[model samples]
Target chain A: MRAAIFRGAFAIQVEQIPDAALLEPTDAVVQITHACICGTDLWPYRGQGPYQPGWQIGHEWMGIVQDIGSEVRTIKRGDRVIASYDFCDGTCEFCLQGLDSACVQGGLWGFGHEGGQAEAIRACFADATLVVVPPEVEGDEALLKAILPLTDVMAAGHHAAVSANVRAGGRVAVIGDGAVGLCATLAARRLGAEQIIVLGHQPQRLALARQFGATDIITSNGDEAVQQALEMTQGGAQAVLECVGAKETIQMAVTLSRPGGTVGFVGAPHGQEVPLGHMFSSNIGLRGGLAPARAYLPELLAEVLAGRLDPSSVLDRTVSLAEVAAGYAAMDQRQAIKVMVRP
Target chain B: MRAAIFRGAFAIQVEQIPDAALLEPTDAVVQITHACICGTDLWPYRGQGPYQPGWQIGHEWMGIVQDIGSEVRTIKRGDRVIASYDFCDGTCEFCLQGLDSACVQGGLWGFGHEGGQAEAIRACFADATLVVVPPEVEGDEALLKAILPLTDVMAAGHHAAVSANVRAGGRVAVIGDGAVGLCATLAARRLGAEQIIVLGHQPQRLALARQFGATDIITSNGDEAVQQALEMTQGGAQAVLECVGAKETIQMAVTLSRPGGTVGFVGAPHGQEVPLGHMFSSNIGLRGGLAPARAYLPELLAEVLAGRLDPSSVLDRTVSLAEVAAGYAAMDQRQAIKVMVRP
Candidate 1:
């Protein structure tokens, strides 16, 4: 099997690797069909995080099960499935509370376990970790790419909106306008927010955000953006989704929210500090983190299958497995919002 | 009339002042029976806040209505009442949302409007601001003093508990051992939290915290306190109430919470910065502010009248209006957790 392996900062290679097999009764081997790049993937790629040479380098995927272990009762070979970026037992106290991302036995794919960037990948806790993709749309190319991002970004965007308690007729502001932020705008729209603002400086990304239902856009001058959002919302946004993992972005999200409003942050913050003083007196709430992707994928998948939502729009470009390295580089250079790779 | 007026930093005097009278159609004149020293009062007394010389100095009180205007429908002359620290119309969008502290036309009694630290007070928006004292409990000294604190501290404590969503049989941690923190412990217990930890170093305050149903105590060392709380709860506390406005206290509260847990911060934050990196990954939420005291007084008054709760236990000493200066000095020096002043 060939896998996209991390060589070092700013480098990746698609090379022959040892084939993965079922290592436990609860495991399943998936032949990767589609995989996509994520903002989080850029962290290690940019030398901001620890990465080992030859490590499997992707976590987003949709695939077909090539083999299933004896104890895997819910899924079998040849079934199309979408797995979350993080694997969980789904029965732990955290999972039961709808915080599967924090599940005690969970393994973060790509980081903690061998990821799904290869031709074939092993998925653990198959019964609890895999979602059987609905069969009615099995051969749809766009839907297949959509599922890959859904395993992480789309679900994360939904989590951000949900955590902020976005409601019908409410004003919502999405900070970042990255893939997740655009998805959040769509999610907020789906949740019935009447007004949506996407704050970003990138022209292409902001244009995509507007297409995704943002009623307004503000370039990354955070202070001015917050002021404009406040004026537009008659005070401040009823809910704010902070999708960027920087201190300024989070602060802007907090300040843009109305008194008693909520700020849901989904970014994997690397070097950010929250201003608690501003939040305390403003009565703003901060909630969100790693998306409970598995918990949300079913509904998001249904929306995608039903054509009520289109997350595939975020897949600005696609490349073959042999060109996976270039895809990563494009994403690293901010030239692409999202890159999909056909395996 | 005689009133305690703030002259400068560390300077307060009980001296002759003009009597208060009805200033609006919705106004009521009350002869204060008991006015208590509050933690917020120390802010101006110590010159830590913006203060003007010879300003009225208190916001917590229970009194007898001496007069009312044509528009005052809720109470008449001779009615005994306990009013919140801030006056609100109770009909604005914020008030309807149960955030009376941010009411559109709200006025703070001590900071901006004429306060209740004197023998007489002119209360605006009387119908929406005052809670009538039950006849049977009007003369009860403990209940009267309790009513004074209810105008601020007790209500603030309840706000903390409510914002944090403290549940029955859940573990709760309270940061700060001020009157509000002690009241927060009591509020958590009332809301059915089975285990309560109060973080503080003062013996007298900690003893009062215990009396208010704190099951454990963590002295000022926040990091050790978080670890101890996590160990006690088998993970992390389900809810944390931050009653001190310091940055470290806010950080500790955020750290002590479990994933998906909330921290209710009622403290008027002086200067605090939140660590967004940890907050984003942990999924901890923060909610609260200057408590909407006007929203909770009715229920709080009912509880006090029924002998189900007592807030006066926080009062460590009492002084005459003439000796209020000493009371402030005592609280500032940690000689007393709280003090009550009789006019």
Candidate 2:
């Protein structure tokens, strides 16, 4: 089997690795048909965070369950499925509360487990960790592409909306123009937010934001963006979705929220610090974190399958397993919103 | 008229001042019958935050309506009423959303306006800023004491519970055993939280917490309290009400919240810093701030009138206007949980 391995900063290589196999009865081998490079992948790709030299490197994929261990009951061979970015048993106290990311016995992918950007990968806690794809739509290329993001970004976007308590007829402001941010715009719309203001720096992405139900867009950065958002929303939005987790972005998210409003952030924090003073004086709230993708996958999948959601547009480029390095470079350089990997 | 004046650090003096009179058509004057020394008042007394010397002090009180401006409609002369700590018009966008503290035209007491500790106060936005006392209950000393906290602490505590989303059968933990923390315990019990854990440093306050419906009490401080709360909760609380706004207490609140749970804080932050890294990784949420006491006063008042709530016990000591300086010292030294002031 071949997998995308992190060699060093700006260096990724698809090399032959031992085939993924069932090491436990609760595990199943998924033959990856689709995978993607995430904004989070850029963290390690740019050497921004600690990453082992030779670790597996993908956590978003959907594939056919090629094999399952004897004890796996809910899923069997040949079944199509998509595993959440993080795996959970769905029975732990955390998982029961829909906080799958913090499941007591769960863990993230590409750490000790097989990477998703490979020919095949071992999925533990098969029944709870994997959401089976509908049999009728299994091989539809466009449909599969649309469903792919449900594994992470789409669910995360929904998490931001849910955490922020976006409601019908309410106003919302979304910070960031990344794939997750775009998805959040769509999610906010689905949640019935009447006004969706998207703040971003990219012209093309901002245009896409409009298509994804953003009623307004601000192309400025930093303080300028906050000013524009606050002015447009008349004081500030009722709910602000922070899809970018940088310090400035988080601060802007808080600043653009109305007094007594909430900021729901899902961007993986690097140097984010919540402005407690501002939040305290304004009665604003801060919520959201690593989204429980597993908990939201099914609902988002239904929306995709029903043709109401189409986040595949976020995947603007594609690459083969051997060219996964270029895929990372494209995303790192902002040349592509997201790069889908066909293994 | 006479009022409590802030002379300097560790200095409070009663001084003769101009009688309270309406400055705006929307204002009404109230003759103070009862007032209270708040934990917040200690800030200026201890010289912690910015405070103007010779400025009036105190913001929690209930009294008979002495006079009303031409435009004042809802409240009239001789009607007993309680004013929220902050005055608002109750018609602003923020106020309509139950955020009276952030009212567009609202302002805190004791800045330019006469403080509650004065013999009389000019209550602005009379129709909205004051909750009229039921005629039948007027002049009832015990009932008035029970209802006085509704002017601030009780309503603020209910705000914590409300902000934290305390629900029936939910597990809750309250940080701080001050008047507000005790009231939060009562609010949590009213909200139907099954397990109410009160964390504080004082045994007497903890005892009061139990009387207010705290099912468990932890007197430990800092990391030890977090550990005990985690162990006792089997993980962490589903809802945590942060009544103390210090940095260490804020961190403890975050550390003791279950993943996906929320910490509703009402403590005026001194040097509070929310640990975003821990919150992000654990999926914990932070909310609450200067509570909208006016929004919650009516509901809490009704509870008191029905014999279902009584928070007056928190006022263990009482002082006349001339002894208000000593009252501040007593609370500062933790000699009294809360001190009542009669003008």
Candidate 3:
């Protein structure tokens, strides 16, 4: 088997690795059909190395179940399925409470577990970790591409909306024009937000955000951006989805919220500290964290099947497993919004 | 007329002050029949003075309308009414959004405005700041006492519960046993929480909490309290009410919440900062601020009128206008839970 390995800053290598096999009775082996290079992948590549040298990388993936261990119950070999970023024991108390992100036995892909950007990967707790693709959509490439994002970004976007308590006929502001932010815009629309304002620096991404249901865009940054958003919303938005994890962006998201409004933040924190005093005095709320992708993937996949959401456009480039390094470079260099890796 | 003045630490004086008159066209003067010393009042008495020398004090009160300015429409002389701690123009964007605490034209009593612990208070934005008492219950001394807590403590507790999103059959933990925390326990019960845990140190206050519907009480403090609460609730509470605003208590409130749960905090923040990293990782949320008393007063007042809520027990002691200084002393020494002031 072959996998993409994180080989220090600005370096990735596709190399032969031991084949994935059933590591536990509850595990299943999956042959990757499609995987993705996430914006998060660029973090280690940019020298903020949280991963050790030669670490397995990549998380978002869809595949065909190649084999199942004796204890695997809900899924079988040859099933078409998608895996969320984190694998969890579906029966954990937290999982039952709809907080799969907080599952006691859960761990993220590629950090300490099998990386999804490989020819094959072994997944534990198969019954609770994989969402089977409906048979009708299995053979449709475009539909599958649209559904692929549900494994991570799209579900994350939905998490932001849900966290912010976005409602029909309510106003929303999404900060960031990345894949997650665009998907958040789509999620806000799907959840029936009447007015969506997307604030981002990238013109191209902002355009896509408009297509995703953003009613307005603020191209400005910092104080100017906050001022514009506050004025446009007549104070601020009822719900603000924070898709960028930087401290400034987090503060901006908080600033963009109306009194009694909520900021649903799915951005992975990077020196981000919540301004409690400001939020407290203004009656603003903060919610959302790492998306419970496994918990939300099924519903979002249903939406894709029903033809209400298509996020395939987020993947602007595709590569083979061997070219995964180039895919990472393209994303880091802003040459691609998101890169799909096919094996 | 006599008003309580903050003369500095451990000192309060009932001095003859200018009679409260219509300070604005939107103002209404209410002769104070009842006023109360809040736990917050003891902050300055203990030397954490946000108020300067001679600042008029106290904020919770209900009385007959003494007079109304030309612009005061909804209230007039002789009408019975209760004023929220803060005066807000109800027509502001924030006020209309049910965040009266964030109203653009709002200010708290006793800070820069006319204090309630006076013979009369000239409430600005009269139509918005005061809730008229129902004629039938207006003259009932016991019922009025029950309703008076609604002006501040009870409404604040309800705000905490509502902010925490306490739902029917949900499990809750209240992290205080003061007037506000006891009121919060009552609010949780009113909201239909099936399992309510009150964590406090004082046995008497805990007993009061039980009467207000606390199913369990943890008399321990610090780590032991957190451990007991976690074990008792089989993890943690779905909604944690933080009525004490110290740094440690705030952290404890966050620690006590179940994953994906919320901490509704109404404590006046005193050097408190949110633990954002822990909260984000656990999908925990923090909400609530200064209670939007004006917004919740009517609903809670109705609850009182319906014989559903009685927070009068929170007012364990009372004092006359001249003895307001003694009331402050008793509260500072924890000799009284709350003190009612009469002029």
Best by lDDT: 2
> What would the per-residue lDDT of candidate 3 be over residues B1-343, giving only the tens digit for each residue?
8889988988888899888887789989999999999998888888885788889988899898989999988997898999898889999878987889898989889986789999998888999998899688755889989989988999999999999999999999999999999999999999999999998888888888989999999989899999999998888898999998878888888888888899999987666356767677889898998899998988998889999999999999989999998898888888889999888
Q: What share of the true interface contacts does each candidate keep?
A: 0.70, 0.68, 0.57
Better of 2 and 3 by lDDT: 2
Question: In model 2, what is the error at residue A161, expressed in angstroms?
Answer: 1.2
Candidate 3 ranges beyond 4 A from true positions: A7-11, A23-26, A46-55, A69-76, B7-11, B22-26, B44-55, B68-77, B136-140, B219-221
Kindly list the per-residue Cα lDDT of model 2 for residues A115-141, writing each as its tens digit.
Answer: 899999999999999999879886589
Residue-wise C-alpha lDDT for candidate 1, range A184-282, written one tens digit per residue: 999999999999988888999888888899999988486777788888889999899989877778878888888889999897765546666667666
Candidate 3 docking classification: medium
Give candidate 2's error at residue B12 in angstroms. 2.2
Q: What C-alpha RMSD separates each model from the true structure?
A: 1.7, 1.7, 2.6
Instruction: List DockQ, one per candidate, in order.
Output: 0.65, 0.67, 0.55
Over A286-325, each residue of candidate 3 has an lDDT whose tens digit, in order, gives 8888889899987888889999999888998999999999
Q: Score residue B152 of candidate 3 by CA lDDT.
A: 93
lDDT of 1 at A235: 91
TM-score, chain B, predicted structure 3: 0.97
Q: Model 2, residue A108: displacement in angstroms? A: 1.4
Question: What lDDT is reached at residue A158 by model 1?
Answer: 95
